[model samples]
Target: MLDACYDTSVVQSAVDLANTLKPVRGEDFLESVGQLHDFLDDHPALGPVKPSEPAEQHAAGARWSLTEEDLAEVRSVRETVRAVLERASTDAAGAVALVNDGLRRSRATPVLRVGDGGWRTEVVSGTDRCSAHLAAAMFGALASVIATLGPNRLGACAGPNCRGTFVDLSRNGSKQYCTRACAHRVSVAAYRSRNNPG
Candidate 1:
């Protein structure tokens, strides 16, 4: 089990990485090395996060140097993370297996670090490969969510034509759509259908 106060930003980073390739739109935002760099820039939590107190840090992987190989490997990790999000609600056991296998391949190790603020746990890879670091951070975050909350908290959006993945961190855990816009769009469409039944 991971820390009870797992970093939600890391969990969101996993979802953001998985959502970079939109299945319903058939659009891939992470197709190039530059895009991969952009992703790293946007989600710094996916990279080697520097602990506030380095002496207490157990492990922090190497800095990312993006490449074609790195892009390919990160995309592969994305597939596994996406699969977990899409399947966890229905097949919790299968999702657990996917996360476990990916974490094993990435050599993910969870470390408890004492920072200026307090103590927190982070997952890091043993190698310098950017993809492995990403896999460790993202897959480990998903695993933490499954262990903390139920596996059903991770899922795909219910909005029509949108396959966006998300972790339902809400207190009630009733999230069906990825965003407020998606939920409102769906609600309005249903209302229109009821009013203009023809």
Candidate 2:
């Protein structure tokens, strides 16, 4: 599981970006490239900040500056990531294979740094576009999540009207809904049905 805070680096930014692009607020808010661009601009963490050679100051990563091509690629990446998450939710091995293949395609490599705090692992990407970076980050974060929390921790929303997905980082791993609002919507609907019974 990713640390509650990125005291280390912006490793979870990809995960944050992925979660945000998903039909914000249970609505299809990210269907078009303009919306995706708006999203990147709306959220600071969603974009990667180009750092020095030693990989320093990653908090304010470089602006994505998405082009027409990048947007198209991002659409594809998002679809593939959603599939990977869904598959991993039910099948761990399959998910691993998918992530490995994606890493290969994105040319992402795992780097080990030996510091005073001991050795640690981080994903390094050579890609320049925002979409490619996010794809790599999505795979890396998902891989880390599977290693720590298990496959079932990631999945799509349970709400009938919502097409969003999420990673359940709750305590008991009993997170049945994507958000509390979705859960409440479902609960209120159930209560109303029970009371009316029409």
Candidate 3:
């Protein structure tokens, strides 16, 4: 199971959620989270967990498919989260603002209250009604991941050709690329640059 710690699964989920809104070259929303979990599960060094299928469908002919507008909204949310992750300092206000913006964009009202020793969230009203619950869940999950990624661990990808932000959970704080593949690409580029100067 993916604990609150900043493990491979948590990092993958954060990146996946953001990328689901605006996928990179070869990512599909349907299998993004699952694939991430699969990788984590295979890596015993990093806690293992079974992958859960996305509750929503992305099929060409599904009764409840994501629309262009939905994609846009998701993208906005992803951008907001990315902004927070890339900030030099922890932005509590910005986090709240982002949550509010997401709720507003979803046409949902989040109910805030002090419970269980801290602030808790709930959806008071909305289109889907369940949207509030989902938002609360997402917020909680993100919070857990953020807690694990101390201020120094959050960063933007250092791949020269990539601009995605990511949470670096490596022990040495040396993670630069958003993904291993990107890291490999960066290495190859560096090697070429060293071997054959322009």
Candidate 4:
């Protein structure tokens, strides 16, 4: 179980990672090593979670080297993460299997961290592999959401032209679209069709 106040950034990062490859729109935001670096920069929570870990202990401007291999591995992680998000609502057991397998493969372990902002639980991987660390954060966050808010909270956008994924952290858990823009687009389209009758 995760702290109720656990940072939502990790959860959002999982969704962002999955949405990087928009299947319906045929747009992939994470294609090159540079793009992966951008993704990592955007989501700092995906960094080394354990403060006492060697990775952090040696943090004298040390950063993981991004390579094609890392990109490939992360892409594979994305597939598993995306599948879990897409299936959690309908096939929770299947989704759980993916999450469990990912966590195991990533060697993820939950750790409690205390800071001025308060205490929170984070999942850190045993290895220094960027993909493994990312998988731990992504999979662990998804698992925490499912444990706390039920599997129905994970879903893909309702927009026909968009298969973007999202984690509903709203109080009502009524999210259907990946973004407000997508939801508005869908609503407007529905209205136009109803009025024109064509």
lDDT of 3 by residue, 1-198 (tens): 223222344345445555543334544453333443333233232111111222222321222233455444444555666665556245655765664565465554434544334554433334432223233334444555555554556566777746566766556777777789989998898999999999
What order do you get sorting by TM-score, best first? Answer: 4, 1, 2, 3
Q: Give RMSD to native, each candidate.
A: 3.6, 4.3, 9.0, 2.7
Residue pairs with colliding backbones in model 2 are: 48-61, 48-62, 49-61, 49-62, 50-62
lDDT of 2 by residue, 1-198 (tens): 344212123333444455655564554455666777665655444334322245433332235555678777877776677676656677778778888887777777665655455665655566676666666656776777777778888777788777566776667787767788999999999999999999
Q: Can you give the lDDT of residue 22 in candidate 1?
A: 92
lDDT tens readout by residue for model 1, 39-111:
8777755645432324422222224556799889989999999999999999999999999999999888888
Better of 3 and 4 by TM-score: 4
Error of 2 at 157 (Å): 1.3
lDDT of model 2, residue 99: 81
Question: Candidate 1 vs candidate 2: which has greater TM-score?
Answer: 1
Off by over 4 Å in 4: 1-5, 49-51, 54-62
> What tens-digit string does per-residue lDDT give for candidate 4 at 1-198?
334744688899899999999897688998999888888877766666444753343331136777999999999999999999999999999999999999999999888877556777778888878899889988989898999899999999988888899999888899999999999999999999999996
Candidate 3, after superposition: displacement of residue 183 in Å? 1.2
